[model samples]
Target: MAGVEETEQVKGATREDTQAADREPETLYGISGSPGIVVGRAVVLRPRSDDLVRYRLEKEAIQAEQERFQEAVDQAEQELKDLRSKFEGDLSDTLTIMDSHIRMLRDRMILDQTANLIEQKQINAEWALSRALYLVKKKFDHIADEYIRDRFADVEYVVNLLQEQLSEHGQQFPTGFAEPVIVVSEDFTPADTVRMQSEKVLGFLTEKGGTTSHTAIVARSLGLPAVVGVENITERCRTGDMIILDGYDGRVCLSPTMDQQKLYQEYDRQHRAFSEELSWYIHLASETLDGLRVRLSANIEIPNEIEGVTYYGADGIGLFRSEFGYFQQKHLPDEETLFSVYQDLVIALDPQPVTIRTLDVGGDKLAIQLPGNKFKALHERNPALGLRSIRLSLREKTLFVTQLRALLRASAFGRLRILLPLISLLSELKQVQEIIGQVMMDLTDEGVPFDPDIEIGIMVEVPSAVTMADVLAAEVDFFSIGTNDLIQYSLAIDRGNEYVAKMYDPLHPAVLRMISRTVEAGHAQGIEVALCGEMAGDVFMAPVLLGLGLDELSMRPSAIPHVKRLLRHSTSRRLTDLAKQILKCGDGMETRALLDCYLASNAGEWRERS
Candidate 1:
């Protein structure tokens, strides 16, 4: 991109040539893309905002502006309604929220109050609109919850558009640009993406948007590399600059040397090769070289991920997270909707074991505006420790029963297993047992053909669960160690927290001892134990788990082949020695050194996989 300088359009003929020739060197704009380049013009999205003096309006003009303001709001409402109708898949709000919000928007109280501001304070429609929006947002933002605070962004985006129109400026899009163009804007908006289809657009650049924002979403869908928050980029870029974009690295170069271009082209080629190679290993069964069989399962969220499960040759579904449904919608789904989704998933994965955990929301996953009483306990200082998972379910028996009923009912359609989360006490499992029994009676009385003998289990996340594992193991058919939370709880360190994450080592001797005890306890009770957290995918920890007598490993599909390859050369006897060395370590580094030495000495096992 060439920096824009004084143009010949305003300069006299004597100085025009000098001005035109005085252009700065070009700089490239790095954006995400499909590993190719198509040079074209830039189309910038211009957001509309009001430029009128609303405070100076006379009474007659103020009244006129109010009428226009009402009309503009009506137009926005109809537009949202029409969009909802047209995009059926996008309609997430219930009838109650949908109709009530629209009603509140047009209510006399809202309009009268806005007009009162205009008449009483002598403010114009533009200021009135902003102020009213600000007030509404203030109430929602101050509601003592993150979810409600998040809604303020949506409110501000909508009001800003209307505010712009109130000042006689309106939003517009690029309709006639057939050339492959990169969108240039301060911040890319949804309207900008909707108007610029994936085919005609090459890429875009913006100085805003978080990694998960609308800009990044569109870029990923189109397989474009987008580096957001690039300060001073707009001022640097200009028309007709020879630009090369390194989408992989989010690098942009101006008038790049041929060597640099060749480097990126090779990088793109090798990356594609790696993805294709990974896909090739998907359908293979997992087994060690010496004939030790291993159970490989998929960790899934949506029903759509079942295809991936099949492709990865997963023996069964290990963890089917249930919170995604609750979070993706505006409100908690009713029993009927939840049942249908559960039933469909069970039938789809028929003849294969499917472990469904109850809604595991709280800590980072809690919701706001749920009738106040439901999650009020989660508002405490330490949410991860305060009323989460099984505790929350026991408190809200109706919600818990609803989920259990759906899970139990789905069992008839497939091999179903139910897992409880965050269990510290045996009484919590007793609550689960009671809820399941009560729901069974209700379902039987209601003539629902639900299966009665689905396997029940609990995640061994808390250290207390480890302490009481032998007794607790007798109550359930199996135990799945949720090492992510177990290590977090044991070390008092959150993985999300960078300062303490390094201290949250799963290989800490105390953590290793806990694993050994829990596995020993499960074995003593004649129940199966499996590693189901990120540790299951850890190559280093896999040996330790195997040493501790873990029967199964559940993890990301991509890690299975590599992990299985590691297990091929490893003997249970040799692995036991490694675990013993780890336990005898003087410090963490000694344990790590022993582990690394063990892996390096056994490197021959990972190689020459059949």
Candidate 2:
């Protein structure tokens, strides 16, 4: 935290700075939060933390200052309401979050507490307000559940908005663009990104964030090029400077030379052309030239992502991450709430099968009720390999049973399947099956209607699951490879740790062999094998997955069209040959080279256009 530039870093494109630079054409490195290329003039955003002049208010000025605070609150509430109105049903999660902020603004606790602080301490409104929020955040911090505690960030964001409103220094994004421009910031919330999507913003560069940040997720959803965690970017560049952003490589160049600008422009053009070509396959089914069909599905964290599913014409919802519901709410959702969501999703994506993954909470994601209410909070040194996913679910039967009943009840409405997460052993699969059988019997006894023949599957993530895929395949109806976790667990690398992220490779010989083995084992038992993870969404790996004879590939809904395009342009036989050659590679680098060669040789149109 010491080396960091500041806390709560959020700035936007500002007017041109007159100061001279120490060096021209400087390059900064960051994580590729989103993928694309853009050449544009830099617009330095107003600093997120402007110097606040905190001063004690005389007792006589307290009432007037309180009125000023109320006015700021009213303005912020109205802004949020207006923004919330702009989004529709498909963005229900964001809308819900916005609604929460509005409610917070209206909450008497915050207002009354701040007013008391102002009257008692004879402090300025800003100081009193900051103290009030700190007290509230302290309460949040004491919450044993990490998911609930992390909501403090939301509170911090709300406080920032109010402070900006009161100071009359809030920056509104430009609605029009004379030419494309890059928006550099220290950070952006999901709401910020959504608003920017309506403007002429070409890409995003931030001093803080990661792949799983909400800003990153929103950027990916909108298909914008973004780079995050570029430390001290604001110190190096200014508004109106020529900039080249290579999102594919996570590089930002300031005051780029003409030759470099031209090179990036061509790269940008190629990226756009490729995206345009992918759009042509939005309506087409995912199939190779040899007529082998592949089921292309979507992975969703919230119910709202169905918009992308409908937009891309995905075959179905393959991985509905049910744990997000737990994270979003203060308390565990009741059976009815879960049932309603699952039912609505099935109705929305009707006819197409929906594989709802049972709550896969733990390891960077904590359940709201599990740790504090049902089980003791864990302090494990290695929770990734500790009690998580099915392990946690089994230990908390009431929680698991409630979700199972909700899922079973919802299954009556549409083509729904239950997929267990992080399964590692035949015994775990057997125990889960036994519990499902008992739940189904109870439901029947109570005359509760559900899909009597609903299929059950398990995620093949742990190395043990892959090793025993043949045995596990015999028990479950299907297998969905959670490649993100599979790669991490197999390679013993923390994917979230930027220091070692490069070592987390899905194309590693061990990982691919596990996948190939899983597919073979599942197919041998006449069970469908699907991939529902980040790897499934990657275009470079789509053909390799297909070549390995996967029945389905599930990824972010935004990516389905591109994968479909790649599939449409390829042949199953050619992909099989490529896979065979890749399987023989000894390391990830060799495997990557083989894949690159295959794509370059086969996708001649892309090559020529580039």
The model with the greatest lDDT is 2
| lDDT score of residue 276 within candidate 1 | 69
Candidate 2 per-residue lDDT over residues 203-247, each given as its tens digit? 978887766566676687677889988988877766666678888
- Whole-model Cα lDDT per candidate? 0.65, 0.79
Off by over 4 Å in 2: 1-23, 31-39, 46-75, 86-97, 100-156, 162-181, 194-204, 216-226, 246-250, 259-263, 368-372, 605-610
Scored against the true structure, residue 575 in model 2 reaches a CA lDDT of 86
Across residues 56-78, which tens digit of lDDT does each residue of candidate 1 receive? 67766777877887887787667
List candidate 1 stretches off by more than 4 Å. Answer: 1-197, 200-258, 367-378, 495-509, 535-549, 556-610
Q: lDDT score, residue 86, model 2?
A: 83
**True lDDT of residue 171, candidate 2:** 62
Whole-structure CA lDDT of model 1: 0.65
Give the TM-score of each candidate: 0.70, 0.81
What clash pairs does model 2 have? 12-44, 12-45, 13-43, 13-44, 13-45, 14-44
